[model samples]
Target: MKFYITFFAFILILSILIGCNVDQPTDVSTSSIPIDATSALSGGDTTILSESSHAFSTPAPNLSADALEKHLDGDLEFEAIFVTAPAEVNPGLGPIYNNITCINCHVRDGRGKPPTVDEKFVSMLFRLSLPNGENGETGQSPIPVPPIPVPGFGTQLNNRAIYGTPSEGTVIIEYSEQTLTTADGARIHLRYPDYTLTDTYKPIPENVEVSPRVAPVVFGLGLLEAIPEETILTYADEEDVNGDGISGKPNYVWDVVEKRYKLGRFGWKANQPNLLQQVASAYHDDMGLTTSLFPLENSHGQSQLKQNPTSPEVSDEILDVVTFYVQTLAVPARRDVNDPQVMHGEQLFAQAQCADCHIPTLRTGVLPGVPSVSNQTIHAYTDMLLHDMGPDLADNRPDFRASGSEWRTPPLWGIGLVRTVNGHTNFLHDGRARDLMEAILWHGGEAEKSRQMTLQMTTEERDALIAFLESL
Candidate 1:
């Protein structure tokens, strides 16, 4: 009789453990784990947390007075609206450009969203390219792509030109909804965006490939640039040698300044070498404003009839100041991190395998003139390497060494506060995901298992995961 009682007790204990693993009836426990309180200081010295519209636009909390003054000077240039030449103050606007000011697209140093069917492109821009060489039969293996710039229109299509010369083209964006049902019977609505470009002022090549990219937040960029190339390369597994199925690679792109191939670290595909180059390139393409690095007009000087701005619209001093501004902008601190649900969500974040590419922590190397960005533990949550995000998100547009389907894993540090700063929660390269859940659902390719794992989670678990993201 005692032996029978022992067997029955053992069976009951086994059943309970199984229930805890699978969560039979009740939800997963929302117990909090004791984490370092300083984890809230996500950007270290550069952290600033505010629930106001200006949250993302602040300078670093610990910057010296001299550094702060330069940041303010850059802010003036960054916010100044350019007009067609002739006037003295901030003259060179555009004979053709996407937006008049940098802040117009960045929107207080926060993410930009895609334009709707009725709207026109302002914050978002399209990349134009043609298949330069041979194509790989399968996307799993890497392929080489040398960009062939389009005639007349060049690399980017500017839909908004200054009055006379026709705008390059206009695009219409629409969405189609799909339903994903979770294992526990919860339904998720996924919206896919469809882009159609029309009203072209010039003839586009039949083989021209268009890539849409929205403006991303500009904070902590110097910190991202300060991370050593060797440190970032350690995360790259181009061949998937370890067989974990996550293959991350660095993009080797042309450095206009260095005039050599270098590890790409900025842009959607990690196409720019540093903050200065990224700034100069943006001025050339987005604003039709040139600098010493790019002295030619954005249109490739296709039309002589069009009035041109200064040979180089932005002076070297102004450009340097602007670079400093973007580099020194602060990353907001995490919110509600100690909440039980938020802590549970962090565990789920790792358990779901989202932390693989969106790496939670990294240490920075030294950066000259910007001590705040150097030698600090940060939670930017990115490997800073390119990965094939699957066919669902493929633009088939190649930039430098990045394949058509691959994209740099964007940082997730200040994501939660995007809405507070920009008044929107649109996520991803093209702003397809309306909210955090949609963004997670859009994950595929290397993140397919994670998406599936997130899909199968209970409502409470899903809420906890989102709660954790919101806290960040």
Candidate 2:
């Protein structure tokens, strides 16, 4: 009888152990987690969490520039709006414009590279606004700041212009470096930017907000657009239900056409949902090219340029062609995974927990007619959600529902080729980081662990890891 009791006790103990291994039912509706007072990396066995679920096969490019002509229609519509001379009639062109042509900013439908010399194309954009917070932990309706008359400095600061003046101001970037040693005794480098404005027409106002955003890569945007809205929202864990330190939430934005809110999955703050709107916005804001969708001219509602006669209205046909060209660009394939440094760095990526936010894969949904983007596994290396990067990286600007300190995860697929494709080696939202190492050091919040671990590695190990990131 005693022997039988002992066996029963052993069985009961075994059952408890098994139950502990199984994840507890999580409450995802609330943005709260049970504070176990343990490390964020604790709990859950990552080994059993199948990475296959994220597997998405990407498609090859058609290898035909001819495919683009069908989309562009021999540039008939674009040529109509093109400026022959500085003062020529430019319908749908900006009254509050930034540049002359689409090629002026995007250059090659590739990434934009900031100038290494004191040339003008290096000028980029900076968005300005203030921070906003939900009244309660329940995430209530956002409260806007009190009305201020005149609302000084209330829009994106343009660094370039056309027709007469070469823009009203210039931005100079100066840098200083700092060396940091990690817990494990490895030295890491840091770069800080000193921004100075020259040739300002007006004095700088006090107590204003500002955030800088560099132009991101334009490739494979259509595939991102083709992804089903529901599929993107499936990853939104507003509450940290699984007990991970990460609390990724979706950003919803106002859809002008539908007259309602929709899932946002593009831009630095996940502000724009579809590629069409994103490109249209850039056309209006960057190159001053006006379109049917955003028919209103860009003014602080106070600029003399708003009444400029040279600016012309852009047509629907040109907008459609440009949108088509941007939507069909393909992503480059992954590089050699067999390289020892790459292989080791990939393992270190997970071990250090960078994969939590920089999710390695997302399968493309069915895209009718465009086989190149249809139903393929893609390694875009993004979660399409927003997370607080802490006050250090906060831009203090709100985009739709996304608050300050929140940013969309950028893809790492073609990072290795940034220097080759764009002929420059700069990274991050503001082009603040000079290289991959500096970019890694800029990581905070959820990626803090990975950054810490990376800094802890030996110089050789860190170089191998950077080699792996460069190879991406």
lDDT of 2 by residue, 1-472 (tens): 9999999999999997775333221221121322341111011111011112111111123413354454445233322444523445654444445566654544444445455555664435666543334412222234322112223234555565545533434556666788878666766677666556556445545443566677777656666776677776777776778767777778787666676677887888787867678767776666656566676544435343545333336666666665665555545534555678887887777777777777776677766645546565566677888877765566756666666677888777667767665666678877777788878888887667777787787777787787777656
C-alpha TM-scores of all predictions:
0.90, 0.76
Highest TM-score model number: 1
Could you give candidate 1's per-residue lDDT for residues 38-103 as a string of tens digits?
777778778765667877888876677688789889999889898877678877666778999999
Candidate 2 segments whose C-alpha is farther than 4 A from its true place: 1-60, 63-68, 72-93, 113-123, 130-154, 164-174, 183-186, 196-199, 306-312, 368-371
lDDT of 2: 0.59
Pairs that clash in candidate 1: none
Instruction: Count residue pairs with overlapping backbones in model 1.
Output: 0
Error of 2 at 176 (Å): 3.3
Clashes of 2: 11
